[model samples]
Target: MDVPYDLTSYVRVLKLASTPSWEEFSRVALIAGAGIVLVGLIGFVIFVLMSVVPGSTPA
Candidate 1:
């Protein structure tokens, strides 16, 4: 499909992806990714614990 855009919209798109520094971007991305993985692991552990409890049924 053909897309349409105005000049201001094009500038906003460019600014969004333009990281001022590589080091800062890498640091932020790594910290954010680690946080996501940590949360996932904690959730999985809780799920497993819940499933193993006496009255719970396994899926």
Candidate 2:
């Protein structure tokens, strides 16, 4: 019996195997995500503080 080959699946598997390991990618991704969250939190705190102060114009 002859087996059928799926070229698309083979290509996808090869591409995934050639990609970077999860550990390396996850580390960079986590750092970037954390940085974004930290910046957002800081900006929110500043915004709240400014809003609570009297006579401050909203930007």
Candidate 3:
């Protein structure tokens, strides 16, 4: 493996990268928060369904 080459590439990327503006950061944060909520809701629904199903062994 070419470790030095990989490190140079990563360093170049870091040098070229810029911080997100407040608006951009907020938009990303909102999208990420929505995704987290949606996943949690889906998991809760699945757990409730499993608990309510007939003949399922209790945990």
> How many collisions between residues are there in candidate 1?
0
Best by lDDT: 3
TM-score of 3: 0.79
Which lDDT value does model 1 have at 41?
A: 100
Clashing residue pairs for model 2: none
Supply candidate 1's per-residue lDDT for 32. 100
Writing each residue's lDDT as its tens digit, candidate 3 over 1-59 gives 99999999999999999999999999999999999999999999998988899878565
lDDT of 2 by residue, 1-59 (tens): 32345777777788888677999999999999999999999999999988999878656
Which pairs of residues clash in candidate 1, taking residues 3 or more apart in a chain or in different chains? none
Q: After TM-score superposition, what is the CA distance of residue 31 in candidate 1 from its true location, in Å?
A: 0.3
Error of 1 at 57 (Å): 4.7
Local distance difference test scores for all models: 0.85, 0.86, 0.95
Clash pairs for candidate 3: none
Model 1, residue 5: distance off in Å is 24
- Clash number for candidate 3: 0
lDDT of 1: 0.85
Q: Model 1, 1-59: lDDT tens per residue? A: 33455776787888888645989989999999999999999999999998889778655
